[model samples]
Target chain A: AQSVTQLDSQVPVFEEAPVELRCNYSSSVSVYLFWYVQYPNQGLQLLLKYLSGSTLVKGINGFEAEFNKSQTSFHLRKPSVHISDTAEYFCAVSDFLCGGTASKLTFGTGTRLQVTL
Target chain B: SAVISQKPSRDICQRGTSLTIQCQVDSQVTMMFWYRQQPGQSLTLIATANQGSEATYESGFVIDKFPISRPNLTFSTLTVSNMSPEDSSIYLCSASGPGGYTFGSGTRLTVV
Candidate 1:
Protein backbone atom coordinates (compact mmCIF):
# COMPACT_ATOMS: atom_id res chain seq x y z
CA ALA A 1 0.00 0.00 0.00
CA GLN A 2 1.18 3.50 -0.78
CA SER A 3 0.06 6.90 0.49
CA VAL A 4 0.92 10.50 -0.38
CA THR A 5 0.85 13.57 1.83
CA GLN A 6 0.96 17.13 0.51
CA LEU A 7 2.15 19.48 3.23
CA ASP A 8 0.32 22.58 2.03
CA SER A 9 -3.41 22.89 1.56
CA GLN A 10 -3.14 26.23 -0.17
CA VAL A 11 -0.43 28.54 -1.38
CA PRO A 12 -0.77 32.17 -2.46
CA VAL A 13 1.99 33.92 -4.35
CA PHE A 14 2.43 36.93 -6.56
CA GLU A 15 3.00 36.69 -10.29
CA GLU A 16 6.62 36.00 -11.28
CA ALA A 17 7.36 34.80 -7.75
CA PRO A 18 8.74 31.39 -7.00
CA VAL A 19 6.75 28.67 -5.24
CA GLU A 20 7.26 25.20 -3.88
CA LEU A 21 4.69 22.55 -3.02
CA ARG A 22 5.88 19.84 -0.69
CA CYS A 23 4.86 16.20 -0.92
CA ASN A 24 5.79 13.10 1.06
CA TYR A 25 4.87 9.48 0.70
CA SER A 26 4.87 6.24 2.69
CA SER A 27 5.16 2.80 1.20
CA SER A 28 6.76 -0.49 2.09
CA VAL A 29 7.97 -1.21 -1.42
CA SER A 30 9.68 0.75 -4.18
CA VAL A 31 7.27 3.23 -5.75
CA TYR A 32 6.83 5.55 -8.76
CA LEU A 33 6.17 9.17 -7.98
CA PHE A 34 4.01 11.54 -10.08
CA TRP A 35 2.64 15.03 -10.04
CA TYR A 36 -0.68 16.02 -11.63
CA VAL A 37 -2.41 19.32 -12.16
CA GLN A 38 -6.15 19.96 -12.34
CA TYR A 39 -7.51 23.17 -13.68
CA PRO A 40 -10.95 24.58 -13.02
CA ASN A 41 -13.68 22.41 -14.56
CA GLN A 42 -11.08 20.10 -16.01
CA GLY A 43 -9.53 16.72 -15.46
CA LEU A 44 -6.11 15.86 -14.08
CA GLN A 45 -3.08 16.27 -16.34
CA LEU A 46 0.23 14.61 -15.71
CA LEU A 47 3.05 16.96 -14.89
CA LEU A 48 5.99 14.70 -14.35
CA LYS A 49 6.97 11.36 -12.91
CA TYR A 50 9.97 9.84 -11.14
CA LEU A 51 10.21 6.21 -12.10
CA SER A 52 13.99 5.67 -12.24
CA GLY A 53 17.37 7.25 -12.90
CA SER A 54 16.75 10.94 -12.35
CA THR A 55 16.10 12.58 -9.00
CA LEU A 56 15.50 15.99 -10.55
CA VAL A 57 12.47 15.81 -12.84
CA LYS A 58 11.31 18.65 -15.03
CA GLY A 59 7.70 18.96 -16.08
CA ILE A 60 5.66 21.09 -18.43
CA ASN A 61 4.87 24.73 -17.79
CA GLY A 62 8.32 25.38 -16.43
CA PHE A 63 7.68 23.29 -13.31
CA GLU A 64 10.09 20.83 -11.72
CA ALA A 65 10.24 18.44 -8.78
CA GLU A 66 13.00 16.61 -6.94
CA PHE A 67 12.63 13.14 -5.53
CA ASN A 68 14.43 12.62 -2.23
CA LYS A 69 14.70 9.03 -1.07
CA SER A 70 16.07 9.68 2.40
CA GLN A 71 13.41 12.24 3.23
CA THR A 72 10.65 10.44 1.34
CA SER A 73 9.76 13.68 -0.34
CA PHE A 74 8.92 14.79 -3.93
CA HIS A 75 8.45 18.51 -3.93
CA LEU A 76 7.31 20.60 -6.96
CA ARG A 77 8.92 23.92 -7.70
CA LYS A 78 8.66 26.72 -10.23
CA PRO A 79 10.95 29.66 -10.68
CA SER A 80 8.15 31.95 -11.77
CA VAL A 81 4.39 31.59 -11.62
CA HIS A 82 1.71 33.19 -13.74
CA ILE A 83 -1.91 33.84 -12.99
CA SER A 84 -2.78 31.01 -15.34
CA ASP A 85 -0.68 28.72 -13.19
CA THR A 86 -3.32 28.82 -10.51
CA ALA A 87 -4.69 25.34 -10.15
CA GLU A 88 -4.84 22.31 -7.87
CA TYR A 89 -1.74 20.12 -7.68
CA PHE A 90 -1.64 16.53 -6.56
CA CYS A 91 1.17 14.14 -5.76
CA ALA A 92 0.69 10.47 -6.37
CA VAL A 93 2.54 7.18 -5.92
CA SER A 94 2.24 3.75 -7.43
CA ASP A 95 3.99 0.56 -6.45
CA PHE A 96 6.88 -0.36 -8.72
CA LEU A 97 7.63 -3.86 -7.53
CA CYS A 98 8.97 -6.14 -10.23
CA GLY A 99 6.16 -7.25 -12.56
CA GLY A 100 3.65 -5.54 -10.25
CA THR A 101 2.03 -3.18 -12.71
CA ALA A 102 -0.95 -2.11 -10.66
CA SER A 103 -1.36 1.37 -12.20
CA LYS A 104 -3.50 2.37 -9.27
CA LEU A 105 -2.45 5.79 -8.07
CA THR A 106 -2.49 6.87 -4.44
CA PHE A 107 -2.92 10.62 -4.39
CA GLY A 108 -2.36 13.41 -1.91
CA THR A 109 -5.13 15.64 -0.61
CA GLY A 110 -4.05 18.34 -3.12
CA THR A 111 -2.68 21.86 -2.82
CA ARG A 112 -4.47 24.83 -4.35
CA LEU A 113 -2.11 27.32 -5.96
CA GLN A 114 -3.29 30.90 -6.30
CA VAL A 115 -1.18 33.34 -8.22
CA THR A 116 -1.86 37.03 -7.80
CA LEU A 117 -0.75 39.94 -9.94
CA SER B 1 -1.13 8.29 -25.19
CA ALA B 2 -4.62 6.90 -24.62
CA VAL B 3 -7.51 9.29 -25.14
CA ILE B 4 -10.43 8.68 -22.83
CA SER B 5 -13.86 10.02 -23.67
CA GLN B 6 -16.39 10.13 -20.84
CA LYS B 7 -20.06 10.96 -21.34
CA PRO B 8 -22.48 13.04 -19.33
CA SER B 9 -19.91 15.70 -18.51
CA ARG B 10 -22.20 16.78 -15.67
CA ASP B 11 -25.67 16.08 -14.39
CA ILE B 12 -28.09 17.16 -11.71
CA CYS B 13 -30.11 14.20 -10.68
CA GLN B 14 -32.88 13.76 -8.17
CA ARG B 15 -32.24 11.73 -5.08
CA GLY B 16 -33.08 8.03 -5.32
CA THR B 17 -32.35 8.02 -9.03
CA SER B 18 -29.51 6.26 -10.73
CA LEU B 19 -26.90 7.40 -13.21
CA THR B 20 -24.56 5.44 -15.42
CA ILE B 21 -21.30 6.96 -16.56
CA GLN B 22 -19.52 5.72 -19.63
CA CYS B 23 -15.86 5.66 -20.62
CA GLN B 24 -14.42 5.05 -24.06
CA VAL B 25 -10.73 4.71 -24.71
CA ASP B 26 -9.06 5.33 -28.02
CA SER B 27 -6.71 2.38 -27.62
CA GLN B 28 -7.34 -1.01 -26.15
CA VAL B 29 -6.00 -1.31 -22.65
CA THR B 30 -6.05 -4.17 -20.22
CA MET B 31 -7.17 -2.18 -17.17
CA MET B 32 -9.53 0.71 -16.54
CA PHE B 33 -10.07 2.40 -13.19
CA TRP B 34 -12.89 4.40 -11.67
CA TYR B 35 -12.33 7.13 -9.13
CA ARG B 36 -14.31 9.65 -7.13
CA GLN B 37 -13.39 13.08 -5.88
CA GLN B 38 -15.55 14.52 -3.17
CA PRO B 39 -15.85 18.20 -2.54
CA GLY B 40 -12.44 19.56 -1.68
CA GLN B 41 -10.87 16.14 -1.33
CA SER B 42 -8.43 13.81 -2.97
CA LEU B 43 -9.17 11.09 -5.48
CA THR B 44 -10.35 7.70 -4.14
CA LEU B 45 -10.19 4.55 -6.12
CA ILE B 46 -13.61 3.05 -6.66
CA ALA B 47 -12.85 -0.06 -8.62
CA THR B 48 -10.69 -1.70 -11.26
CA ALA B 49 -12.56 -2.86 -14.34
CA ASN B 50 -11.11 -5.59 -16.44
CA GLN B 51 -12.45 -7.07 -19.61
CA GLY B 52 -14.17 -10.46 -19.23
CA SER B 53 -14.07 -10.22 -15.43
CA GLU B 54 -15.98 -8.61 -12.64
CA ALA B 55 -14.65 -5.37 -11.34
CA THR B 56 -12.57 -5.39 -8.21
CA TYR B 57 -13.84 -2.67 -5.92
CA GLU B 58 -11.95 -1.03 -3.13
CA SER B 59 -12.96 -1.14 0.50
CA GLY B 60 -15.92 1.04 1.50
CA PHE B 61 -17.34 0.59 -2.04
CA VAL B 62 -19.47 -2.31 -3.14
CA ILE B 63 -21.06 -3.73 -6.27
CA ASP B 64 -24.52 -2.92 -4.98
CA LYS B 65 -23.97 0.81 -4.86
CA PHE B 66 -21.61 1.07 -7.80
CA PRO B 67 -21.81 -1.46 -10.58
CA ILE B 68 -19.15 -1.59 -13.28
CA SER B 69 -19.21 -3.10 -16.72
CA ARG B 70 -16.38 -3.86 -19.09
CA PRO B 71 -17.71 -5.60 -22.16
CA ASN B 72 -14.60 -5.03 -24.23
CA LEU B 73 -11.12 -3.65 -24.00
CA THR B 74 -11.97 -0.17 -25.21
CA PHE B 75 -15.19 0.59 -23.36
CA SER B 76 -16.49 0.47 -19.78
CA THR B 77 -19.38 1.80 -17.79
CA LEU B 78 -19.99 2.58 -14.12
CA THR B 79 -23.51 2.79 -12.77
CA VAL B 80 -24.08 4.65 -9.55
CA SER B 81 -27.15 3.21 -7.90
CA ASN B 82 -29.36 4.83 -5.29
CA MET B 83 -28.20 8.36 -5.59
CA SER B 84 -27.92 10.51 -2.48
CA PRO B 85 -26.37 13.78 -1.40
CA GLU B 86 -23.27 11.87 -0.46
CA ASP B 87 -23.01 10.63 -4.02
CA SER B 88 -22.51 14.15 -5.35
CA SER B 89 -18.98 14.25 -6.60
CA ILE B 90 -16.81 14.02 -9.70
CA TYR B 91 -16.44 10.60 -11.30
CA LEU B 92 -13.37 9.97 -13.44
CA CYS B 93 -12.09 7.07 -15.50
CA SER B 94 -8.49 6.33 -16.32
CA ALA B 95 -6.29 3.97 -18.33
CA SER B 96 -2.57 3.32 -18.45
CA GLY B 97 -0.31 2.40 -21.34
CA PRO B 98 3.33 2.63 -22.33
CA GLY B 99 2.97 6.41 -22.60
CA GLY B 100 1.40 6.84 -19.16
CA TYR B 101 -1.92 7.12 -17.39
CA THR B 102 -4.58 9.28 -18.95
CA PHE B 103 -7.86 10.40 -17.35
CA GLY B 104 -11.17 11.51 -18.74
CA SER B 105 -12.60 14.96 -18.32
CA GLY B 106 -14.82 13.63 -15.49
CA THR B 107 -18.53 13.72 -14.77
CA ARG B 108 -19.84 16.03 -12.11
CA LEU B 109 -22.87 14.49 -10.44
CA THR B 110 -25.02 16.58 -8.22
CA VAL B 111 -27.71 14.68 -6.36
CA VAL B 112 -30.45 16.98 -5.27
Candidate 2:
Protein backbone atom coordinates (compact mmCIF):
# COMPACT_ATOMS: atom_id res chain seq x y z
CA ALA A 1 0.00 0.00 0.00
CA GLN A 2 1.07 3.58 -0.63
CA SER A 3 -0.02 6.86 0.91
CA VAL A 4 1.09 10.48 0.62
CA THR A 5 1.01 13.36 3.05
CA GLN A 6 1.05 17.06 2.21
CA LEU A 7 1.13 19.03 5.43
CA ASP A 8 0.10 22.42 4.08
CA SER A 9 -3.29 22.89 2.53
CA GLN A 10 -2.45 26.37 1.34
CA VAL A 11 0.72 28.39 1.04
CA PRO A 12 0.77 32.12 0.40
CA VAL A 13 3.78 33.87 -1.02
CA PHE A 14 4.81 37.01 -2.88
CA GLU A 15 6.03 37.02 -6.43
CA GLU A 16 9.74 36.27 -6.89
CA ALA A 17 9.86 34.72 -3.43
CA PRO A 18 11.09 31.22 -2.82
CA VAL A 19 8.61 28.55 -1.77
CA GLU A 20 8.45 24.91 -0.77
CA LEU A 21 5.57 22.45 -0.83
CA ARG A 22 6.21 19.46 1.38
CA CYS A 23 5.29 15.91 0.42
CA ASN A 24 5.88 12.62 2.18
CA TYR A 25 5.00 9.08 1.25
CA SER A 26 4.73 5.70 2.96
CA SER A 27 5.18 2.45 1.07
CA SER A 28 6.58 -0.95 1.84
CA VAL A 29 8.87 -0.77 -1.20
CA SER A 30 10.63 1.81 -3.23
CA VAL A 31 8.25 3.94 -5.32
CA TYR A 32 8.11 6.52 -8.07
CA LEU A 33 7.29 10.06 -7.00
CA PHE A 34 5.66 12.79 -9.04
CA TRP A 35 4.57 16.38 -8.82
CA TYR A 36 1.66 17.72 -10.84
CA VAL A 37 0.18 21.16 -11.20
CA GLN A 38 -3.39 22.04 -12.01
CA TYR A 39 -4.13 25.55 -13.13
CA PRO A 40 -7.50 26.99 -12.36
CA ASN A 41 -10.26 25.18 -14.30
CA GLN A 42 -7.78 22.90 -15.99
CA GLY A 43 -6.54 19.35 -15.75
CA LEU A 44 -3.40 18.03 -14.11
CA GLN A 45 -0.10 18.71 -15.83
CA LEU A 46 3.00 16.79 -14.89
CA LEU A 47 5.69 19.00 -13.43
CA LEU A 48 8.36 16.49 -12.51
CA LYS A 49 9.03 12.89 -11.50
CA TYR A 50 11.59 10.90 -9.54
CA LEU A 51 12.27 7.44 -10.94
CA SER A 52 15.82 6.27 -10.34
CA GLY A 53 18.80 8.54 -10.87
CA SER A 54 19.28 11.61 -8.70
CA THR A 55 17.57 12.81 -5.56
CA LEU A 56 17.07 16.31 -6.96
CA VAL A 57 14.84 16.59 -10.00
CA LYS A 58 13.90 19.72 -11.93
CA GLY A 59 10.64 20.36 -13.74
CA ILE A 60 8.80 22.79 -15.90
CA ASN A 61 7.78 26.33 -14.95
CA GLY A 62 10.99 26.63 -12.93
CA PHE A 63 9.94 24.07 -10.35
CA GLU A 64 12.02 21.32 -8.74
CA ALA A 65 11.76 18.63 -6.13
CA GLU A 66 14.11 16.70 -3.89
CA PHE A 67 13.55 13.09 -3.00
CA ASN A 68 14.81 12.36 0.49
CA LYS A 69 14.77 8.64 1.16
CA SER A 70 15.61 8.94 4.85
CA GLN A 71 12.72 11.26 5.43
CA THR A 72 10.30 9.53 3.04
CA SER A 73 9.77 12.93 1.51
CA PHE A 74 9.77 14.51 -1.96
CA HIS A 75 9.19 18.19 -1.41
CA LEU A 76 8.79 20.62 -4.34
CA ARG A 77 10.73 23.84 -4.39
CA LYS A 78 11.16 26.92 -6.48
CA PRO A 79 13.93 29.46 -5.97
CA SER A 80 11.78 32.27 -7.28
CA VAL A 81 8.11 31.88 -8.00
CA HIS A 82 5.96 33.79 -10.46
CA ILE A 83 2.37 34.87 -10.19
CA SER A 84 1.60 32.49 -13.02
CA ASP A 85 2.81 29.69 -10.79
CA THR A 86 -0.21 30.03 -8.56
CA ALA A 87 -2.03 26.75 -8.80
CA GLU A 88 -3.01 23.56 -7.03
CA TYR A 89 -0.08 21.22 -6.59
CA PHE A 90 -0.35 17.53 -5.97
CA CYS A 91 2.21 15.01 -4.76
CA ALA A 92 1.78 11.46 -5.91
CA VAL A 93 3.41 8.03 -5.52
CA SER A 94 3.28 4.89 -7.60
CA ASP A 95 4.37 1.37 -6.78
CA PHE A 96 5.50 0.57 -10.29
CA LEU A 97 9.22 0.85 -10.81
CA CYS A 98 8.96 -0.09 -14.48
CA GLY A 99 10.16 2.62 -16.77
CA GLY A 100 7.57 2.27 -19.51
CA THR A 101 4.43 0.90 -17.97
CA ALA A 102 1.63 2.26 -15.79
CA SER A 103 0.61 1.80 -12.17
CA LYS A 104 -2.06 3.08 -9.88
CA LEU A 105 -1.05 6.39 -8.32
CA THR A 106 -1.71 7.43 -4.75
CA PHE A 107 -2.05 11.18 -4.37
CA GLY A 108 -1.77 13.52 -1.43
CA THR A 109 -4.37 16.09 -0.62
CA GLY A 110 -3.22 18.90 -2.87
CA THR A 111 -1.58 22.10 -1.64
CA ARG A 112 -2.80 25.32 -3.17
CA LEU A 113 0.00 27.78 -3.79
CA GLN A 114 -1.25 31.32 -3.98
CA VAL A 115 1.34 33.64 -5.43
CA THR A 116 0.52 37.32 -5.36
CA LEU A 117 2.35 40.47 -6.23
CA SER B 1 2.43 10.34 -22.43
CA ALA B 2 -1.10 9.67 -23.58
CA VAL B 3 -3.68 12.44 -23.74
CA ILE B 4 -7.16 11.78 -22.46
CA SER B 5 -10.22 13.54 -23.88
CA GLN B 6 -13.13 13.44 -21.44
CA LYS B 7 -16.55 14.81 -22.22
CA PRO B 8 -19.75 16.17 -20.74
CA SER B 9 -17.33 18.70 -19.33
CA ARG B 10 -20.01 20.10 -17.06
CA ASP B 11 -23.50 18.89 -16.33
CA ILE B 12 -26.38 19.55 -14.00
CA CYS B 13 -28.59 16.56 -13.37
CA GLN B 14 -31.62 15.85 -11.26
CA ARG B 15 -31.55 13.54 -8.29
CA GLY B 16 -31.77 9.82 -9.11
CA THR B 17 -30.46 10.52 -12.60
CA SER B 18 -27.28 9.08 -14.01
CA LEU B 19 -24.39 10.49 -15.99
CA THR B 20 -21.76 8.70 -18.04
CA ILE B 21 -18.41 10.30 -18.62
CA GLN B 22 -16.27 9.14 -21.52
CA CYS B 23 -12.56 9.26 -22.07
CA GLN B 24 -10.64 8.54 -25.23
CA VAL B 25 -6.90 8.18 -24.96
CA ASP B 26 -4.72 9.24 -27.84
CA SER B 27 -2.57 6.15 -27.50
CA GLN B 28 -3.23 2.64 -26.33
CA VAL B 29 -2.83 2.15 -22.60
CA THR B 30 -3.00 -1.03 -20.56
CA MET B 31 -4.84 0.42 -17.62
CA MET B 32 -7.01 3.45 -17.06
CA PHE B 33 -8.21 4.80 -13.76
CA TRP B 34 -11.07 7.00 -12.62
CA TYR B 35 -10.97 9.56 -9.84
CA ARG B 36 -13.42 11.86 -8.15
CA GLN B 37 -12.72 15.19 -6.51
CA GLN B 38 -15.45 16.57 -4.34
CA PRO B 39 -15.69 20.32 -4.05
CA GLY B 40 -12.86 21.77 -1.98
CA GLN B 41 -11.24 18.35 -1.57
CA SER B 42 -8.54 16.19 -3.05
CA LEU B 43 -9.16 13.48 -5.55
CA THR B 44 -9.99 9.90 -4.56
CA LEU B 45 -9.58 6.82 -6.68
CA ILE B 46 -12.85 5.42 -7.85
CA ALA B 47 -11.81 2.41 -9.91
CA THR B 48 -9.31 0.92 -12.32
CA ALA B 49 -10.43 -0.22 -15.77
CA ASN B 50 -8.57 -2.83 -17.72
CA GLN B 51 -9.29 -4.04 -21.20
CA GLY B 52 -11.25 -7.31 -21.41
CA SER B 53 -11.87 -7.45 -17.67
CA GLU B 54 -14.23 -6.03 -15.12
CA ALA B 55 -13.14 -2.86 -13.45
CA THR B 56 -11.51 -3.08 -10.03
CA TYR B 57 -13.21 -0.61 -7.75
CA GLU B 58 -11.95 1.04 -4.61
CA SER B 59 -13.12 0.26 -1.10
CA GLY B 60 -16.11 2.58 -0.96
CA PHE B 61 -17.17 2.28 -4.60
CA VAL B 62 -19.28 -0.46 -6.18
CA ILE B 63 -20.30 -1.48 -9.67
CA ASP B 64 -23.93 -0.73 -9.00
CA LYS B 65 -23.04 2.90 -8.52
CA PHE B 66 -20.09 3.48 -10.82
CA PRO B 67 -20.01 1.08 -13.73
CA ILE B 68 -16.97 1.21 -15.93
CA SER B 69 -16.27 -0.12 -19.39
CA ARG B 70 -12.99 -0.50 -21.19
CA PRO B 71 -14.11 -1.41 -24.64
CA ASN B 72 -10.58 -1.27 -25.95
CA LEU B 73 -7.15 0.02 -24.97
CA THR B 74 -7.92 3.57 -26.02
CA PHE B 75 -11.33 4.26 -24.57
CA SER B 76 -13.41 3.87 -21.40
CA THR B 77 -16.53 5.19 -19.77
CA LEU B 78 -17.60 5.65 -16.16
CA THR B 79 -21.26 5.88 -15.25
CA VAL B 80 -22.53 7.39 -12.05
CA SER B 81 -25.74 5.66 -11.18
CA ASN B 82 -28.61 7.02 -9.10
CA MET B 83 -26.75 10.18 -8.36
CA SER B 84 -27.58 12.24 -5.34
CA PRO B 85 -26.22 15.52 -4.08
CA GLU B 86 -23.34 13.64 -2.56
CA ASP B 87 -22.44 12.28 -5.99
CA SER B 88 -21.70 15.74 -7.29
CA SER B 89 -18.03 16.01 -8.00
CA ILE B 90 -15.36 16.30 -10.66
CA TYR B 91 -14.57 13.12 -12.57
CA LEU B 92 -11.28 12.53 -14.28
CA CYS B 93 -9.74 9.71 -16.29
CA SER B 94 -6.08 8.92 -16.58
CA ALA B 95 -3.68 6.71 -18.53
CA SER B 96 0.05 6.37 -18.52
CA GLY B 97 2.79 5.92 -21.06
CA PRO B 98 6.59 6.15 -21.08
CA GLY B 99 6.45 9.84 -20.24
CA GLY B 100 4.06 9.26 -17.31
CA TYR B 101 0.40 9.53 -16.49
CA THR B 102 -1.82 12.11 -18.16
CA PHE B 103 -5.30 13.11 -17.08
CA GLY B 104 -8.37 14.34 -18.90
CA SER B 105 -9.67 17.86 -18.51
CA GLY B 106 -12.31 16.43 -16.14
CA THR B 107 -16.07 16.36 -15.98
CA ARG B 108 -17.69 18.65 -13.45
CA LEU B 109 -21.01 17.19 -12.39
CA THR B 110 -23.61 18.85 -10.24
CA VAL B 111 -26.57 16.89 -8.93
CA VAL B 112 -29.52 18.85 -7.62
By DockQ, the best candidate is: 2
**Clash number for each model:** 0, 0
Worst 10 residues of 2 chain A by lDDT: A95-104
Candidate 1 residue lDDT tens string, A72-108: 9999999999999999999999875223135688899
- Estimate, for each residue in B57-98, the C-alpha lDDT of model 1 and write its tens digit: 999999999999999989999999999999999999998776
For model 2, the stretches where C-alpha displacement exceeds 4 angstroms are A97-101
In angstroms, the error of model 1 at A87 is 0.7
Off by over 4 Å in 1: A97-100
* Model 2 Cα lDDT, one tens digit per residue, B8-61: 899999999999999999888888999999887888999999999999999999
Provide the RMSD of all predictions against the true structure, rounded to 1 decimal. 1.5, 1.1
TM-scores of all predicted structures: 0.96, 0.97
